[model samples]
Target: MGGFRSRSESGRTGSGDKGHDKGQDNRKRQGGNRGGGRGGNKGYERRSESHRREHDNARRRIGSGDRVRDIVFEVLRKVSTDAAFANIALPAALREQKIHGRDAAFATELTYGTLRMQGLLDAVIAEAAGRPVDKIDAVVLDALRLGAYQILRTRVDDHAAVDTTVELVKANGEAKASGFTNGVLRTLTRTPAETWESRVTAKVTDPVARLALQTSHPTWIAEAFNAALGGTPDAPATELADALAADDARPVVHLAARPGQMSGEELALVTGGDEGRWSPYAVYLPEGDPGDLDPVRDGLAGVQDEGSQLIALAMLRAEVADDHGRWLDLCSGPGGKTAFLASWAMGDRATVDAVEPAAHRAKLVRTATSGLPARVHEGDGRRLAEIRGLDMPVSPEGDGFDRVLVDAPCTGLGALRRRPEARWRKTPADVAELVPLQKDLLRSALKATRPGGIVVYSTCSPHPAETRDVVRAVADQTGAVIEDATALFPDLVESGTLDSAPFVQLWPHRHGTDAMFFAMLRVTA
Candidate 1:
């Protein structure tokens, strides 16, 4: 990451001030192309401009010879050293490098694919290197990983994957390690991917460990899914394996149409995507970037997972005894759910008070709900029961919100497809660290909600400790009654596979959505 600074298109060319001045002088000597209209200068101008433009283009193309590899390597190195998120860092790097179309798509696939299969790749790398990967230089290891991914997963010519990887190593000033990289990747291409996978997973005696290597998930996370899904005696082993496989596959981009901003059909029609099956507001983009759409640019729609949209919609779908129309999003930073709730509340002449501790995220909430009936409060949501005044008037009763949503933060294991490096980044200890904050946020949300009102507790993880354990612990302390939350999504719960009663866990494999857990509670006096 130290060597890798994002280079702009201009910087890639290795252009100098002298070159710029010379091009300017050439332009002046040749006269203008369109305006001058001088007989001889016209031909001269066209030649001058064409030559100058080609020279500029050549400069831009200098360091960009093997662009796809360079982009992938840069992203991989950053993820390794800076601990940067690939989803966020890759796009910015691609834009800075001016990569688009098929090239951008290739770069994206290579980067995400490489990161996702790093564990499996490393196993094979160690076999090929005949030494532990830990002993290998980090830069060289990155090159080997990228090369291994191409040879194993992609259809790139085996020779090109190895040759370009060696070239990439040399480009990074690791000339001595190029021979080592070549040896490893060439050996990688010699074996079929299936053979390599079998060889890597052969010695894993633990079922969970074997599955983890096969699916490229950490052993603990795979175990967590098994426990969460197999809480009942009837759960099958294949269900957990399928869920892990789904996490490794490419995820379709889901777009949410803001209420009164756009319709799902309209979003699909505009973006050439299809309507999502689960949520009314969801539009599924099969592939490509969502930011390119007009509705997204205009704030009429946004990139949100369908499962997330379902949880937000459940707040409106919940049959509250008294609909106070005041909603509270206790942890409303980076407000995807808050925006959904706010959009629906505006139609009902209600308002939403979104509380976030971070000021920047509060600003993001404001921007997401810009012209909607949402008021963003920059304060700790744990004290949401106390904050009375927001942008709108206060309720006569204290914090009397009819519906409250606590989308408490967790390890984000459910979004592994979108966040390829998450599996390696998260640990079992992280789950322990998150539970207290998650419980506090849920408790505060319950406190701020009105009696007989609905409180939706959710997380983007399926860990039993975070989902059921936290809910049951809080219920025991607060004496809140768990509602039939599954009834809220009747269509999805038809098979009863997704219905865990009082709670709903949507799986990537089962529901084609993230493993989002939702539990609805009714506050009692």
Candidate 2:
């Protein structure tokens, strides 16, 4: 997302985060405009009148043309009106607005933070406005979300946050709604975020709903994460809150140093990053534009989640009998895993065939594996077995790939950290809609694998409907043997199992990785 903060600000503890509001900080925030700034109480009546006039005067400063806030508002507007992803939209907005340094950091925080905490922000906005957020105009609501986020969360002075946002609304052609925006934000400034949390969730009685409010997640997402952690609907797992909070936290970038080209330690030293805890090839980027680094630009290494690296690592480690040096990435796109696989496969003189139906993503796969012995095929993965003329080996002993990967597409629930606003964009219906394709892809992968071959089915989601359930049905239907995939990473998955099933679900809280689900299947028939 290109978000950065001063090392000092980044290193500070959570006391400075949302809802803490220390006494010193509050006094600093007020700018001597509220609470006991007067020489005398003046019997409370006069004090209240005096405070209101001064507050209005402060709000009148407008503070317009704040390029940082303007960048954030533009990103939010794109995300709201055009459904643009914040990470993609933010960097472009920053460059187009020519914002950099702390100003860029402020814009990044406001963009990501507001979107990440959108659930809670909208709840507070609703109560303050005495109406549902949907009742407000979309463009106007974007301005309000920005203002409320700054006032309630960041250390931006209350009046500056309000005044700048009122101008932002006017600049966005919502001059009429500027009054409504100002009134709503002024109402919000009266209470601290701690009190507002209680006010927003006062009537929400469900345990899942309460967790959602507390953690700024949609209730269903919290419930889904809870279920993936072994809780039932409306109930929470023991670690549910911790899991959601970890997912809600800002994620550090992980880069995979392409095998045979660079080692993790060498990359870490050169890039000023740290070697990752689990994956041998993983490097944790402390903070910087990875594109500015040589390794990334030269394709010696690429940005990928350590959890994602594990998916390819497990495939490499899985035992395949009479290996034929042929591998298939059944749904490779944006090619992170495919590149990782091809880099490792180079040592064995192996070839990789990648299938991606989208033309644009197919180009990404091609570019990501440019110098590698990988083939890119733009077609549905479900037709892999039927595409007979595609030059794959058919050894009569059992003609199919020795190893197959079905990184099936799903709702991407596990990757909420990278895309802050996605939780609000997803729905239970999305999981339901994707389940059939997930099963179909897994079934195709199993069919495309020869006897004694291994097929790894994975998703960047822990939702049961997309992970264990899909693997279970395909394995049962195909009579494939289920291997305890947790054994592949015994040190990483200390629990040895997920809900006692022979599958691995790496979580953000437990592994500090995306909630990736892995199931390794062996074809015995």
Candidate 3:
């Protein structure tokens, strides 16, 4: 399974703190004060105490200069010792330590930033340490990598980075190793490796290796994105590095109106983005508490990406007949797309079926589409066709579905700005492993569709293996033809030029949206 565990098995459930027993004891003590004379004051005092403890824990877990160093070390330790993923382990650690607010934000920055820049960071570390980075203890290597990131990229004080890392070493029950941590960090910070520049400037080299080391992407991914976009290999590598380096805190929230429930104008007043974009009904929200929006709070609006909305709209535009038919979201999870599809279908009197394999995510899809009239399935998309044959919710009576969306599970390289740490954690092997799974999902979605139905294969990543190659392979195998995605969604097409392939690709630097790729394939029955 490419080291990918199910969410529950991964410990992603929202447990608060893991290391401290004092918090639990305090809570129990507070419960005993429920019938006491000073109940209100005691309650306030307990809450204050809890907040202080949380803040202190945050500081200890990820201090200012040591934030990225500590987190990356922890992630690496968990990954090496427990065979954990950076994505699953890092988030769990942050939440468990009650690291929120600025401290939490800093921890996120350090962890993700170090991961994204690991290729470069490791190169620097290797040169400075005068030894291969892989030979080092995973914990010590991660700690050094974290320290390298702060010294090279961040404005954190050098002394603080060194001292705090030493503290992290000691706090981690490695008091004897604190001197080693301090020695390494100080040596590297004092004399950063000069080999990185020479490596970047060299030309006669392995393309993937060059890209991976210099651009901080797995070599295969650089090749895949380059091949998919028909661009020079160097361009995608540079772009990937830039995307990874982009600040994570600036993510924009998108708000959409519930179909026939709220107007765009109403949503605009709440979200406050430019309301005159391609999807007039959609608005981009600047950074704010989305829960503060009344419509969102009341379930009349949802927080989704504009790129995702465009994906749904592109599929809808493929074939909008007077007769409303069925729609399916093959991999609807955490249900953003499912909610949008359900709302649109409900307003148009069209039936929409959303399928998700995971129970928790499927429940989220159900909750997101609760007020809308849509069927939610807790089954895998790869098995949907066979499941339908065995009296599943999918009926054989009408057109299987007029529009089917296969938002396949991907490496998510395109959505790097949103999932800051993902770029760091993902490897070439990860993308390679996801190709077969994505191919199967797309194939299943095609088989479940009606003759004239459109199967839209979408990915948050611009990687060719996961996006273009997968779609092309499926099309060739099934004899499904590719149509012009821009022609279908003209509003989404760039205004200037139209001389190329059929799929639609949105880029962050170019489209001002998350880099998303979409291809509309018409299955010939």
Off by over 4 Å in 3: 1-104, 191-208, 232-250, 263-265, 274-278, 320-322, 388-399, 424-433, 497-500
Which number leads on lDDT?
2
Give the winner by TM-score: 2 or 3. 2
lDDT per residue as tens, model 3, 1-525: 010111111112111112123445666687666645676767777896787667656655555344445665677666557757666787788777667787766776677666666667776656555567786656666677677677666767778877876676555544444555665566555442333334332632775456456656556655665555455754453454344333233566778776578767878976676563656557778767788888898888888777788888877767744334578888989888888777777767887788888999989988898878778888878887554422223444345577889998887887766654565567888877999999998888888776667889999888777777898899999888888888865655556322235877776655566768889998675
1 or 3: which has the higher lDDT? 1
Cα lDDT tens digits, model 1, 287-386, are 7768888888888899899999999988889997647688888889898888888888878988898888888888999999988898888888877545
Against the true structure, candidate 2 has what lDDT?
0.82
Candidate 3: pairs in clash:
115-424, 116-424
Best by TM-score: 2
- CA RMSD of each candidate after superposition: 13.4, 10.2, 13.6
TM-scores vs. true structure, each candidate: 0.84, 0.86, 0.75
- Which ten residues in a row are the worst by lDDT in model 3? 1-10
How well is each residue in 260-331 modelled by candidate 2, as lDDT tens digits? Answer: 899999999999999998898999997998999999999999999999999998898998878988899999
Q: Ranking by TM-score, best first?
A: 2, 1, 3
Candidate 2 residue spans exceeding 4 A from truth: 1-63, 385-389, 494-501
